[model samples]
Target chain A: MTPALLDAPAEDRLAAAIGEMARRSSSAVAIVAQAGSAARCTIDYGWLSRAIVSLEAGIDAGRPVGIVARAARVETLVVIAAACGRQHVPVAFLAEDSRDLVGQLRDWVEVDDSLSLPAAAAGERGRREFETVPPQVIVATSGTSGPPKLVDHSWDSLLAAARLAEHWHGLGWLLAYDATRWAGIQVWVQALLTGGRLVVPASRDPDVVARALVEESVAILPATPTLLRRLLTSADRGLLCRSGLDRITLGGEAADAALLEEAQATFPQAKITQVYATTELGEVYRVADGRAGFPAAWLGKALPGCVRLAVRRDGELLVRLSRDTAEVGTGDLVQRRADRYEFTGRRSDVIVVGGAKVYPKRVEEIVRGVPGVAECRIYGLPSPVTGELVAGEIALADPLPENATPESVRAAVLAVCREHLEPHSVPRILDIVKQIATTPAGKTPRKPHS
Target chain B: MRPDVPNAIVTAIATVLRDTGRDTRPIESGMLLAGDLGLDSLDLAQTIVLLERSLGCDPFRSASTSRSVRTVADLIAIYDSAVAPGAS
Candidate 1:
């Protein structure tokens, strides 16, 4: 599909917004109240231009730029706008360790302490000029390998992704504003480009967020599965059902079929869709309904100019993007069934013992049925004799009403798995963890066990 | 006690922090939530959930206000003033 913004230059709207901010700083609250009763205060756009100008001043002073940033907030948006206007490469930070953040931003010349954008330059009617260049953002990504890596994307690439996303989704966004990570960058820019309101929260509370959705009449919300889970659990069934949301899109981590089913049950009116994309690759496929598996109906549709997907010779998934010609193969294994393919967990997450192949998610499905087990991660660990054996790391929902032993939990999990799985798929050893390994977004971390 | 501070606010916050794997020993009021207790954003969300169940006021009402709270004292101060006499 032809992205609406593609015909025109990418920076036109952003440039116009910067000009507007330059003219009106004091008249309105561009970034609203962060705390107290004034927590919802809205600062004018001029304040944002001023913040950019001030931050640009630091960059001019040979300072590495470090912005304590969030997304969807007026300040954060302004800062992002300002940085883009000033042609400064903004290094977006996550809600991770500050020390780690500092280390990651070591190359930055000036760091803005304000987590949100500073609203100093509000309204000055003048010609606001910007120097465009390749994207210099040190974006944090959940690389195919380890604890996310920082990748650089030119402004062109990001802007293209935004335009493409807006075109594909057709609905404007009510960004979770969780952070300026992958989800945030896509949602905010697309909304802004389309002149759609970027709904910012008063807080991260599920109840508060739920209220905001109703109050704002937010049509679309892109969120992690964990956040959606908490939102559904925070109140009665009618909470999200009556809210006039059109679509609730889930991404970042893998989707749990049970949770998707729960969402469908709760919000019968709203369409529930699952999206799978990475920072390295802008959204590849937006699966309409992956509750059963990857939706085939949505496949073969015109992808953004940036994405192309195909199964590799080794049965893994491979991607080729416009930005990069080299196909970056993913760890996920897919088995084609006619035109639609089924996700067989990650190739690395598979266990093979005694010439038998097993997937962790298959084992997890069985373990999830066991009573008192909150969550589980299954992977293969090295065993001298079997080469590798199935292992499970389980987190109990709540201590077994006070007297539950690890042995009891293990027995329950194994029994459930044995009842469902074949002899080869049953976990040989199970370790009880206090909590499942999750990324900051709360997706269960399912690295290969070995 | 300060006019804004509640009688059991400190105990409540400490209990919440303990659930997050913080040292419960002599749970002090001055302990910083992230700096000293290793609590992250997720833990803060959990703390809000706990306080709502135990106390009444939600210290994390919106994103704008919640980001400023770095320490337990900071959180307690906000929570105390929110639940001060005659305030909900």
Candidate 2:
């Protein structure tokens, strides 16, 4: 544990590793907590140490402490590190309802309890010093998105990822995303290792996130394709007029050409990186240029000791342990291109509309091309006439350009789909939204409208 | 198609819920899943296994169809449609 602190520079250590980051970095506001206007708060490490002490105390009790936190908060970082240090198995839950979340936890635990930072800090210091423990992380799976499946990870697994990430980029602003599930867990660990500042905006709104590139002096942004498209244009323009960000990384969902181009246009100064990781396998690939499609080239050779990637006969991605023999078959459908591979969609995401096979991305790509549409998600529904029908959920850019009604947007989307797809591939039910509800990582919820 | 097929599934699902000591009503096509029954994401996985074992139908393989089966009726419709040809 002492070497963990000695091995890293002060800037790269966790709040628990360094004695006074919260106090010394008073001017460098580390986190901004925002809900509405007045409820917003910002803090440096000075006040944060108190919160960490509370987390440390809870972990000392040998109780499994679970944290349900807002994204990009320093308190979130401290609690995680404290849980890790105190040997307390830390479980994080990010879902829609607290009540429902409690219900889900019922099977796992008999007693329900919550620890608030403000309350925990009320007591004075005790003799209990936090101890290092074996790490376990529980991440919810998409199949269980309505409720999440807990995936566990070890300290070695998480640290290996950090070392690999540090090998790629030295230090800069880490644009962290709360990709719906456990993906966000990596963001915190990466920041702790790199000793770089974490940048989040006043809101998850793409516009605010874009502006923050200039306002916060951002450098590295890791996100899903859904969010990359939204912030790219604004960040690019903001960068041109002022200081710019450096890197944009996409994962969680596949990014199409249009989406990648949009991100490049937004942050022209940033390098575009793609990630191939899952809850099962920490991080399989680090596509620095978003080229190479297969994990074999990216993970097998490049990060040889880190991960092993294989493609099954049906084009499904498989991961074998880099150091061991555990093999994991991923459900994502992929295509190999010369030296690189690309994600097609989820095996479970395919829909048979009418008699033809329809992929949600195929229709989603076409629908995204329509003017005035901000974001869209496509799924299949059982149709009496066609066996399955393409259905879509859409969010419009505010003040839907001149004459852009939901009908017109649907018409434009349909016309594009019709031109490129069979009639069966066209969406039959199109629901409009003020904004698409997305998980922190930037993935559209499987049942977006629901 | 026999009218009893859908009824049998509806009755079985209700019984499963009841066996868990959950007070449930007779199954209707319109009953919302998450809202009407406390069956959540975990419950759905549990229900799917239970339904497969009880109904003795081929394990539902299609994701597109799984996405469409939102309600008890939707599940019943899928099960009923599959049983129709065999029941004849």
TM-score of each predicted structure versus truth: 0.62, 0.67
List DockQ for all candidates.
0.01, 0.02
**Model number with the top DockQ:** 2
Provide a comma-separated list of chain B TM-scores, one per candidate. Answer: 0.65, 0.64
lDDT of 1 at A48: 56
Which 10 consecutive residues of model 2 chain A have the lowest summed lDDT? A106-115
lDDT of 2 by residue, A93-164 (tens): 443332244444432321112334333422233333554554354455544244544445554555565543
Q: In angstroms, how far off is A392's CA in candidate 2?
A: 1.4
Overall local distance difference test of candidate 2:
0.58
Candidate 2 lDDT score at position A373? 85
Candidate 2 on B1-88: residue-level lDDT in tens?
2456566667656654643346777667788877877654433543554445466653354444544656878877777776666532
